[model samples]
Target: MALEKFMKIKETLLGVDIGYDSVKIVALRKGNGFHQLRSSNIIAIPPKSLQQKSADLDKIAEAINTARKTARPRISEKLAVSGLPESKVFTKIIQVPQMTDEELKTAVPNEAARHIPLSLDEIYLDWQKLGENSKNSFDVLVVAAPKFLVENYLVLFKKVNLELIAIETKGIAASRSIIKKGEENTIIILDIGAEATGISIFDLGSIKFSYTIPHGGNTLTKSIAAALKMTNEEAEKLK
Candidate 1:
């Protein structure tokens, strides 16, 4: 999941966030010691476009392309990064006997099967060594995503001609982007999206837990519309 380590430093990086309600794109230029936002855009998706059993990849891809074009007329760097929804990704922190990197490579896969509910064949696995504990055990952060879900992302990015350099969990991306330094005390982050809400517990400079609720802003809007006998659009504006 942390594919950024393998990427060559680029002048600009494109961020693509494909949500249930909208496709968002942002271009950032790396500066001397900071990043400058070049341009950004958001395009709404058709209602229930992503909630169906089989999503319409074509329409989703089209929305992403439109957002990219509107975000920046011509982004020089095609390298991009995207996030998998918190609900679709599985993450766990496990303790293992301290071992060399080579040994952990083989050990992690065997260990992951116990922590992750899905079969090994159904997921793409990745891991990072956190640090050693007092008991001489290493804490490793394991991440996995369903193969089909990841393939859809690849296909969508292919259709839009952006090189997907990395795919991170939404919680990781949010913490990295917004959490300030020296604020390492345990804190909860609530990401309220249109169709879902992501709750993440961040502490010691990493995410300890992440959960998603199916209800979000759209659900509230629907409730308001029903109670007031107003249109969804009107309720949305009022909200």
Candidate 2:
């Protein structure tokens, strides 16, 4: 559907990506069978707040409020979807001998024991089949997360009455936006952010490898600030 011809609805969805030094919101309108682009913007959040065990919900609310105000025509939507950073996520690709869909029901626990460090009861686990293997085996990527981190984020959503549709790790969201289906394989997508840079390796329309570099532009700016005796802003400008 064309952008202007898309459905218009009273509902607006705010997508907030909590970054190290800021919170960004890509406000979207939920139309019939689709979402229409309203407006998108970002706001700088206070430091050390997002790093805590619990994020300050007030700050998140404020950032969304700001972005909504800045967009023209104004937005009346309050529902928001938040994204989780990838650093805390634990993921692994596992290959098992040819097994039917029914066979996996019985074999997952055993396979999980060999691959996951925590007992099955200790973690919230999820897995999806990628495709079939050469020898009639199955290829699956198992994802697990600490219960505490998951709950910590849930609290943020509750504070503002913003419904949480789904929480996705940073790598997964970036891959969806950056990687194209049936495109040339072996292409690398690099996204440079404030505290880290994500390196995703796409192969055969799937993300095969995802890595993050601890060193980012901010790190280099900090290095320059300390070495050259300048303020952070000056160091960043020089860089």
Candidate 3:
């Protein structure tokens, strides 16, 4: 029927997470009822690439190349979703006066300017209305990701031959992968990677709040190395 055809979902979304120490690729087929996972793989980033503030592009490209080979039989849909590190994204939930959609669209930018320390031109801003608050104002989740960092991901995806469609913070993506639809409880999702740790509180399928700590496994390794007077490699094994 036309209704069924209209509601059908067709695109397969491939998620690529390029972490400080590794690259991960996940492919899923989306349908009207549920999404099915097709493939997933992770590969390590080349040495010294993680030491810099901006990643080394040549090393990143090499990691992606290794990931593609490990994940195998290239994904059918080239369009992909990528995540920014927590350090690169700023998220806040604020209350604003409830108004018409058109009115709120105008007010959101003004409100975002107040909360986000960066200039509007320096970041990509997005907001989601989270219904009304107790005081009759609207509760909105605002997200701001730095433009230069976003551009770096776009360039990386281009080198890997993937069309980038969506860029979300890693906390949101972690909660989405683990949380089920229509869930009524609140849960904290923790993603501990090589160089950073992201903690997100998800309530009823929405992210209530998120925080990223600077420490990760690498930090522990360094601490252990110093305490035990061992090399980094030996401390890693102790972990």
Candidate 4:
């Protein structure tokens, strides 16, 4: 597993949002309906090309601690590591015949093989059943991330000494927060994040399809930077 090294959990959770212009870290002492948001802030990245492999794990860890100190000066512990959008992640919902838990258990891997191009051994596959009553067939939400990506993320998390409970997408979190249901109608949710925009269509709370496009606010910033001959920071401020 990617988190095998850094999986030793410490605090509650440290939600790290790696934006194009800035790296934002949020420390949340979660509550029932809300969280204290113990600490939160944005840290500027080095002034250079910020593609993959450009970020230094040590510096990112330092920034997380710095942001926490700036927001809540008395915080004492490191939190769990969060995940970014990995390219290998594939999300889908397929309907299978109703069966017992034992049957579904056996069927999921087989279904994964039919859908996933690579062997199940090459990837970490996770799935959830969305309950019955979707026209008699069971609906399942599935996610697959390449082992390499997971490993890279865990390496960074371990460097920061933050235990990772789960790796999730901001798009999923956004849907959980901002979506408004109207009589169980199908809807497509689009979140224009700094680096990417996600499109997820859900019919009555079940995902039909989910996709992420490379172009986003970051793309716009880069375009503005190139056109206006300005730095990414300047172009981002113009946004």
Residues 1-239 of candidate 4 have per-residue lDDT tens digits of 43323333332456776555567776766465445567677887653212355456666667766766777544445656454563336777777888887888788888878887778887777888888746667887777777666666677678766766667655555565466655288778887766677888877766778888877888899999999999999999998
The worst-scoring run of ten residues by lDDT in candidate 2 lies at 1-10
Worst 10 residues of 4 by lDDT: 2-11
TM-score of each: 0.87, 0.78, 0.84, 0.74
C-alpha-based local distance difference test score of model 2:
0.69
lDDT of 4 at 105: 78
Report the number of the highest-lDDT candidate.
1
lDDT for each candidate structure? 0.82, 0.69, 0.78, 0.67
Give residue 182's error in model 3 in angstroms: 2.5
- Model 2 clash tally? 0
State the TM-score for model 3.
Answer: 0.84
Instruction: Point out where model 1 deviates above 4 Å.
Output: 1-8, 47-54, 72-76
Alpha-carbon RMSD, candidate 3: 4.1
- Kindly report which residue pairs in candidate 4 clash with one another: none
Error of 1 at 36 (Å): 1.1
Residue 28, candidate 1: how far off, in angstroms? 1.0
Candidate 1 clash pair list: none
Tens digits of per-residue lDDT for model 3, 58-111:
779787777767676665557677888886688888889868889888898898
**Which stretches in model 3 have alpha-carbon errors above 4 Å?**
1-8, 29-34, 46-55, 72-77
